[model samples]
Target: MTPTTAPLLPPQKPFDPRTATIAIVTFNRSGLLSKLLDSVLEMEPRPGHVLVVDNASTDDTTEVVEGYRERFGDELVYRRMETNTGGAGGFSEGMRLAYELGSEWIWLMDDDVEVIPDGLARMGRWGERFASVQGRRYDFDGSEFYWQYRLSIPLGIPIPFAPAGFDDSGYREMNSGCFEGMFIHRSVVERIGLPDPRFFIYWDDSVYGWLASRLTRSVIVNEFVLKRTREIKQWDMGTRHLNASSDRYRYYIMRNRGIMQQYFRAHGAYRPALFAVGTAATFAKEIIRLTAVERTVRGTSHLFRGWRDGLKIARDRSFQTMPPLV
Candidate 1:
């Protein structure tokens, strides 16, 4: 069966950058966060306000933000969390504040990426036509980030698009998107609510993007907008790119599959056999990578534990409402 498509948003007034708020979530990456803020400040038509959620960084993040405040004045709004809430929780708080601040559009991103000078303006043009839109991301070396692909629910894997999948003339519908350079409108947030902070990390953006797709038209605009500065070389398995993630990341990634499963099952889109096969395939890949590349089977236990625990995680029915940040 074909995937559900987002309906085109009704025509509205012309795009205005001043009505947008850029929401950035950062954790202990003060240097990179400074670069990202510099780029955002250089936008041709800068956003009306920039809301930053510092995820309890034990670094000079506060000092870095203070420098920006002196330069940008009241255009910047900074909130520092008392604990590390991870990416999921940080974004939830930032988006919540942006909505409460009366922003018409909220552009969400991480602190490790630098926005292209004209990227926000171009995205605003598409925002006039679509309720939710995402711009393309490129690597520091200027290559397009190849892994930004739509997820195939049946296979539980990302489906890479051919060159033709990108259309310069218009937006392409998608069911999933990353937080990096994702532009969400106020109406979509009102309809679907804030992203579930329970995820605390992996797959949170995927689930939130999926919710947006179901509620309204979400698309990926065919324009390069943000550049990923960090370079992570994944294990080059012949058929797949196996990430050599840390023990903590491994747990979250494996465990988050259960959350995705719960969401799919409730939506009547679950394919049990296919998901099981997919899960097995992932396990095999990680095992092979650990033995070959890492030269040890050290953290395989976490993988098993995460998978088992994840399956028991229930779906949060009230995920639409934002939770208070500690």
Candidate 2:
């Protein structure tokens, strides 16, 4: 008897930029948001729709969005939340709307970055091959953002890859990607559903990216799409780049780390004892970095409190499909 093999799939059709929806999640940075919108509008083959999810900014975010609405008319859709939903919520809602609008591809980004003129075109070129393609981000100083690397499943940390290793003709498979300049296909969204809004902030993008990787192939494209305009001061701890994040950020980091541990344990990604050890190591490293580098002990309490709450937080199975944004 002859062994049978699965039939080869047909080549994917070329992606159309006009079928893509650019979703920008903004907080109080109205000026940066406006600049980002301007850059998006200037793309040669502009996305069919630009969905701006305002996280209830207290500033003139509404005014800035209104100006863009006047210029782009219906092409720009601004949805302002009644309250701040953080990055997780904002992206979830924006993605839901984009999906409902029937966009073939949804590009997620933050207001702090500006897309290069040919960014969409480059992403479109690779759209046929990968379910999710993350473009490289350059810092304002023209340096590559080295920290935006693939996540190491066991260590639960981003592992940096050399820039020269990228292939210009295709993408390299990745386990995870950041929300910034992440171009996702509609089919991937249908498979994985939406990012868990309960995450509030930290680890949400990582979890969503990981979920997509489990269902379909996700890759990092060699082309540069976005430039991070803001400069983040970081105290390097050899392998980790510890940013001087806020107390709130610290809480989310610790809490989300716990939640992620639960996720890994449930999926058999790691043995419970091994995950516990890794968690303890992660917590210890964070505390040491905070004390030695930041010269501050203010976030210690928040860190412990977050760890406690995160372990108690329930696992959300409903993240497959996002609820409608009110």
Tell me each candidate's TM-score.
0.88, 0.88
Model 1, span 68-159: residue lDDT tens: 98878888999999999888999989989999998999999999899999988898998888888988878666666654447777756556
How many pairs collide in each candidate, listed in order? 0, 1
Q: How do the residues 1-326 of candidate 2 rate in per-residue lDDT, one tens digit apiece?
A: 00123211213998888799999999999989988988987888889999999999999999989988777888899999999989999999999999999998999999999999999989988887777888888876777665455776786755544343665555677777688878898877876678778789988888778767776667887788899877776775443456667778878877887667655665557455655665676678678767766887778888888878776652554322343232
Candidate 2 segments exceeding 4 Å error? 1-11, 160-164, 167-170, 236-240, 314-326
Quantify how close model 1 is to the true structure by its C-alpha RMSD in Å: 3.7
Please report, as a residue range, the 10-residue window in candidate 2 with the lowest summed lDDT.
1-10
lDDT of all predictions, in order shown? Answer: 0.79, 0.78
